[model samples]
Target: MGKFNRQLVNEIKKEKEQESAQLKLREKYEVPEDVMIVEKDNMIKFSVRIIATLIKITIGIIIFLLTVVGIVSLVFPETRNELIFQLSNTLMQLKKFLNI
Candidate 1:
């Protein structure tokens, strides 16, 4: 749809489904300790791994977005000047707020 490749879309969906299945299998079969004292260890491990991965993905996305913005700012003189002005104003406000 909308000039997009259907094959690539299907591939992405398949990959996503595979990852979901793997995560479910991990929860079903993972053993993280020797004693096996902790109840629901597999579920806990799954949850922790999911949360950590989500956080990592979010940070990576933020960095990537900032890099793209920086590149755009550097490529365009008008954008560069406007970004600098806004960034400086924001930084100054942050600095004053932080008493720094």
Candidate 2:
């Protein structure tokens, strides 16, 4: 065969390989015939899972910070007194607001 013919054959082979790869990827991602697919429900479920994960992470961080603060307060009498005073002030403010 001529050089041009050989080059054409190689190009066709490369194109075929690329097409097969794309087809495999499509097949892998395609939903099965027996399965039901609802995009709206799937989106909502994914969002709810993400929000729940974030809420769990935030709660974990808050608990860790509270634990550290409690330990520090136990080791420092001044901090414990300040914490108590600040808590009382906050409660009093809330009490006034609730009375209104």
Candidate 3:
């Protein structure tokens, strides 16, 4: 019975060693060179996309403000006529200023 117990203990120690080796192997991780390059390209693409979105948002805001001003002028007829006259005068002045 003592010999059998010793053999059983040896078997358990061998199994433990094998499990530890497998765990160590599983812990090993590596990133490939191409993966790093792809990550950098993705980052640049995301940045450009963000800048484009910001430009679109800025244009939308400017259009919204112009629409609001136009609506306000239309709601008051006197202001609407004045705004049109002023806009024409401003455009004519700009054309003359640029000699175009």
Tell me the whole-model lDDT of each prediction, alpha carbons only: 0.83, 0.82, 0.80
lDDT of 3 by residue, 1-100 (tens): 3456888899999989866655554555343333321123588889999999999999999999999988999999999899999999999999999999
Clashing pairs in 1: none
TM-score of each: 0.50, 0.45, 0.48
Q: How close to the true structure is residue 79 of candidate 3, measured as C-alpha lDDT?
A: 95
Candidate 2 local lDDT, 1-100, one digit each (tens): 5456888899999989866666665567795544433334588889999999999999999999999989998789999899899999999999999994
| Tens-digit per-residue lDDT, 1-100, candidate 1 | 3787989999999989866666666676784433232234688899999999999999999999999999999899999999999999999999999999
* Model 1: CA > 4 A from native: 1-41, 94-100
Best candidate according to lDDT = 1
lDDT of 2 at 47: 95
Candidate order, TM-score descending: 1, 3, 2
Local error of candidate 2 at 24, Å?
Answer: 32
Clashing pairs in 3: none
